[model samples]
Target: MIEQFFPELKRYAEDFVASYGYTAIFLISFTESIIQPIPPYPFIVSAPFFKLNVYMAGIVALLGNLLGALAAYYSASFLGETFVKRLLGEKLYLKGESLFNKYGFFAVLIGEPYKLVCWLSGIFKMPPLVFLIASFIARSIRIGAFVFFGNFLEKFIS
Candidate 1:
């Protein structure tokens, strides 16, 4: 688990959400989509604990992820494959490239290691419109599920 290696990161996320609310959600989600190792789920889950609106947090997170994905896409496009491969590492870059080659645009929908998919989409020159649409749909479903689970857990605990 991430905590085993980066305990401070977990506390920092919690503290960030507690201190900054929706802004924290957006930043956390955005960073996760781009490069942050920590996922946004736990931050979203902690929303209610901070008296934040879970549904609104989900929407904010979704928007942040969309923007971050776009940024990643564009970065890979302009920066070239070699730069991206180095940033993402050879193994991950190769794996993402493989998935994109195998699945085409649908790889964005697959959403495994989501950042890699975004980077690969750009590196491979996927149609921008298709990438955006697929990312929106996939991220909506993914964030919605996390919000639903977070809400359920909040209620269960309360």
Candidate 2:
């Protein structure tokens, strides 16, 4: 099928990750952290397969994801509770608020390492400094995971 008509497509996928690697990684991390639908960790993991391309992929993922988190945070902060309640529905708004209070930025710490959690932490009105610190800690953990699992990740698939 694909290979028969365009055998090079497969090879392209490999180079594609390397060639446009930074842009794609950043887009996935940053956008997904906001209202977009991509996940962050997978891209970082996917990048290591190319070996030389891996470090750049990881960096792109981190910056993009952090940018996405900032977007989510600002969106939530400026939107206000009343607006959030109207958009998210009272039930979710209440739950989010509770979670925000219960975990503080640490809650985001758990999820932000992935992407969406970073923004959600911001939205819940967690302290800015806390969010920043927690995000950094979580991201560091995630980055470390990438490095530790680099070899294994080459063949990772879901």
Candidate 3:
């Protein structure tokens, strides 16, 4: 359904990323981790249009995102569930706690259900080394896919 919006979406993505360059990559990744509802796709897709190397763009996205994720995780862990309950209200925060308790690794995949799992892993206090490994896998998959499609994918598929 949303595929129909590609013309407008592509313009917005390309323009924003092109205008902001690498800084946009940092902001998108950073905000996605904590404050906002954005996913990392737009940043990744926009890289090619800006003449930025996709590999470096992906790495910038990863570093910024990881920092934001780790920060959010520590915030949640340090503040404790009680504070989260009070702030977000008991119902919503408890759902978050339950998600962490039950399907921890899988929950990592849901926030953006793609690359943005980095922040959730941090929020859940997944081990640093483990989180790093998980991030490597997730971000690698995203960057690989982004580059593949943006580069040779159309020819291969066609």
Native RMSD of candidate 2 (Å): 6.6
Measured by lDDT, the strongest candidate is 1
Q: Which window of ten consecutive residues has the lowest lDDT sum in model 2?
A: 111-120
Clash number for candidate 2 = 1
lDDT, candidate 2, 99-122, per-residue tens: 767877657776522434554565
lDDT of 1 at 109: 94
lDDT of each: 0.87, 0.64, 0.62
> RMSD in angstroms, all models?
1.4, 6.6, 4.6
Please list the residue runs of candidate 3 whose C-alpha ends up more than 4 Å from where it truly belongs after superposition: 1-16, 86-89, 109-125, 153-158
Order candidates by TM-score, high to low: 1, 2, 3
- Locate the minimum summed-lDDT window of 10 residues in model 1: 39-48
lDDT of 1 at 137: 94
Q: How far out, in Å, is residue 138 in model 2? A: 1.2
**lDDT comparison, 2 vs 3, better candidate:** 2
Local accuracy of candidate 1 as per-residue lDDT tens digits, 1-158: 88998899988988888899999889988888888878777767667788987888899999999999999889889999899988989988887777888988789998578888888899999999999999999999988998998898789878
User: What is the clash tally of candidate 1?
Assistant: 0
